[model samples]
Target: MPKYILFGDYCENALEKRTPYRQDHLEGLKQQKETGILVTIGPTKDNTKVFGIYDAENAEQVTELIENDPYWKNGIWTDYEIKEWIQAF
Candidate 1:
């Protein structure tokens, strides 16, 4: 499997209206991690950005996984970009 990074920002209105769902979103990611779909995930320390790393067979698989996320499906994220990543450490 290869690894990729997903970079995104939360929609302002969604952030304001769905605080509890935000926690659910994170819990979902944690489940994915336990299932071996997610390598890691977190928000930037300053809180302006968010990202996730995943181990997948290909970019399309990664896209499908991300697109199905409650956060992405509910418009919690305003924008996102995905890129193949090389993990040296």
Candidate 2:
């Protein structure tokens, strides 16, 4: 498996809009966590961005995981990116 980083920028008013889908979003993360694909996930201190590290076979697989998230489907995440990560010792 390869490691990848995921980043998402919330839309304007995303905080208020995210309430309904928050639980679903969390459930999705839980599924990934159970599979051991999600490494770590959280919001930035400022709450403007969300980021996570995931272990998957490839970038496309990670992208699918992100695309299926409720936050992404419901437009809470206005924009996002997935980058293959290379951890340095």
lDDT of 2 by residue, 1-89 (tens): 78999988987777799999999999989999999999999888777899999999998998898888888898888788999999996
lDDT of 1 at 37: 78
> Residue 29 CA error for candidate 2 (Å)?
0.3
28 Cα displacement, candidate 1 (Å): 2.1
Task: List lDDT for all candidates, in order.
Answer: 0.80, 0.90
Task: Point out the worst 10-residue segment of candidate 2 by lDDT.
Answer: 6-15
User: Where does candidate 2 stray beyond 4 Å?
Assistant: none
Candidate 2 total steric clashes: 0
TM-score, predicted candidate 2 vs. hidden true structure: 0.93
TM-score of 1: 0.82
Please give the clash total of every predicted structure, in order. Answer: 0, 0
In the range 1-89, model 1's lDDT, one tens digit per residue, is 78999998877655475575677777877888898979888777755577889898888988887788777788777688889999999
